[model samples]
Target: MTVHLPILEAFVKLGNYLTDFCENSYEKPSDTHSKFEMVITQAQHQNGWFTRENILFALKQWGDLLTEEHLTAWLSEYTLKYEESPKTIGIVMAGNIPMVGFHDFLCVLCSGNKVLAKLSSNDKVLLPFLAQYLIKQEPLLAERIEFTEGKLEGFDAVIATGSNNTSRYFEYYFGKKPNIIRKNRNSVAVLAGDETQEELQALGEDIFRYYGLGCRNVSKIYVPSDYDFEPFFTAIFKFSDIINQHKYANNYDYNKAVYLMSNFQIRDNGFLILKEDEGFVSPIAALFYSYYESEEALRKYLTENELQIQCVVSKQKNTDDVPFGETQKPNLNDYADGVDTLEFLLEL
Candidate 1:
């Protein structure tokens, strides 16, 4: 069977609804939008990290990308061959960021596969609510999507996302099936020491958005040995209010105390902590930094460690570098862990 056009249309309508609702351009009051607001509230209540701002940001990004033109362009690259009986794709979602696994969900559906989604408990509210909206738009979608709180069974293929530790377990469990298992990866920014204040400010968005809890967030930076952080600090001062959130402040205080007790040198503003560490993943409210002697050596290091990195935030776009502030706003084709999810689904 060919890919279903109604499924595509349903998602486009969902994209329009999300855009209008987020932009406050909805022509009139409707139950869907009202209930969507409630779902956002419920999501935040379920997960403290799912703050209203972050959820809205995720929604708006999806809205902007889910347009007909963007979807068409994205799908044009794929030969969306479908089986006579759609394969049931079991997706194990991660909850670090709101609707983080939505791209996999989209891939499964658009490739004419059934989705048996196992939502992370922390992110249970948003996708199911959106799924209901999509089902409302096209009733055919109701049969294609399934949510399960129990162990996922009766699926032909699997996609799972988790930390490095849990990935071992996923491999053991889902290894027999056709699977795409993602492990922990963090993004890093390569700073040339000549970035403008505006670029640094935009880098702050890459760092602070989602409270540094996302894989695409710049948890680490590669800076010149003589780099001055004063300008970077000054540019990111506008985001200082992030400390007002209790959860973030608690993490800030805790990590600061730990570093201080260990007598490690750390750079601290009132809100953000910068530690000169050669690690990729940083704790919430903290950033890790490493000194780079030359661009050639840094490029070599990045190429060698590409598997551990999700994105490379830079002033210039390389094949894999995401622009400073656009890490979280990934295009539909920006598959996680550099895996082509749509192609995987179609092959299944």
Candidate 2:
């Protein structure tokens, strides 16, 4: 029952086909339409958050990562010596965004383990569809992947992703099992006030992608004291069309009203609201900003709240932050909550 690496490589090939079709084809094929094409519609209907753009973005990112070369390179650093000790790894996935819990699923499979996935109701269809596709590509995979509708059981270890409150429940229930229970984590950006207009525009993607629902999306930014926001506003103005989205607009309007009633000063460029606050998670369509006296002070703040922070975006030298706007474009090894998922699975 050793999970051959080529079986996983075939899985990547199937992913490429699915993603390329989604990204390139606009009109549905008359009769030649494949099974994968139907997933886009199914995913959207199942989860309102799974828009065409966001689902396609997630697919494309996986397409880029699931290449034969990329997969080989990524797995080269680790030994596949754990195939002899395969364990059932139960996954309690989160459906905040399209395929948000995919990394854990991928990690478990790549580590030569059996996956018993309990998908979030918000995102139930996509992963199961992908798992079916993988089974089709490599029939042996059918033995390894299973999706459960009821409470998860018969698993030696588990990987669950949820909010801070739900994590306590996970801890209480799965405390004895070897687990990687992820709580809430939000990414942040540190502005040096010297970033280019292009960089700021890229930062808008880090903020607005998934309507700021992802852990990788930046919910807050730290700027230097007295930093001029003219360029920042101007750069992000291009994304004002986001207000056209019904869900996002509703959030924008509601958060704006709450802020106004509370007398908290907020700057609005129509689509997004910018507020000065000392917080990590901001409401949708609103970005919280705080002032830092110096780079050192910002570094100190980041270090102190290291666990709460996912990734830091900046362009300055000598800092350990990720490059501006690359938070969501994480490498395969960039494990969530700073935990190496594959390493955990392999050791289990």
Candidate 3:
């Protein structure tokens, strides 16, 4: 079945509502002065409540890509060509960042699925508000979307996201049903010494956005041996203002201290560290490091470890090319980890 015009209009309306809400109502630097203050106030001294600034930043970043034309094209492509419809999809959301579930929610809705979304307590408010706005714009959506704190059953399939630790539990629990269990996967960047200062600055957004909490955050850097760190440092130093935020500062201070006390040798260029390691994923506020003797060696390592990687961002394009800053901001056609979710739904 083709996606109806009204449903596509509703998505566009929801996008507009989010954009207006962020620009007008959400806290801005001009209004709040400090994001830390807004975070503390919103959390009521409770830990893990996302700040208004961070939420707004993420929403606006996503809003720019979720244009009316983009939504319409995606709906038409998936529904018309793929033949996925009326799917009962249960979504298990991640709580590490604000509105992390929005993409999955859009996928289910665009695939003509009934979404049984189990929201993370950390992100319960924003998604429901957005869903309500969409429902208001087109009341028919109210019947298709459901939010609940309870366990999900009676769904035809599941799309579950969780940490590596919890992924095992998710697989065990939902393995009986048709599911795509997303385990912890980190995004990485391959920095050839020749990157322009302009490119390095844009890469900083991928590193610092959401305080390096999201999985799409580039937690590891593969740089050539004997590369000058000065230019890279100069490019990312603009984010020094992130130190002013108390939570991120605390994390930085804590991690720096731990590195000092443990006597773990590290390569620091002031704002962030580049430690030599093998793993792709690193802790938030911390990054892993690897040095390559040559591009061939790096390609060999990446090829050998293909199963362990999710997405790779690089300047040289042979294949598997995604734009630099676009790692975290996935477009409608960019299926997660290159898995065709719509195809899976159709088979079910």
- lDDT per model vs. reference: 0.91, 0.85, 0.74
Judged by TM-score relative to the true structure, which candidate is superior, 1 or 3?
A: 1
- Candidate 3 TM-score, C-alpha based: 0.88
Estimate, for each residue in 172-289, the C-alpha lDDT of model 3 and write its tens digit: 8999999988877777888888999888887787788877877777888888888787898899888878777787777777777788798888767555766677888775567887
User: In angstroms, how far off is 35's CA in candidate 1?
Assistant: 1.1
Question: Ten consecutive residues with minimal summed lDDT in candidate 1?
Answer: 24-33
Best by TM-score: 1
| Winner on lDDT (1 vs 3) | 1
The candidate that wins on lDDT is 1
Query: What's the TM-score of every candidate structure?
Result: 0.97, 0.95, 0.88
Indicate the worst ten consecutive residues by lDDT in candidate 2: 28-37
Error of 2 at 223 (Å): 0.6
Clashing pairs in 2: none
Candidate 1 structure lDDT: 0.91
| Ranking of predictions according to TM-score | 1, 2, 3
Residues 180-258 of candidate 2: C-alpha lDDT, one tens digit per residue? 9999889999898889999999998899988899999999999989899999999998888889989899999999999
Q: Candidate 1 lDDT, tens digit per residue, 66-179?
A: 988999888988887644588899999999999999999999998988999999999998999999989988997888899999999999999999999999999999999999
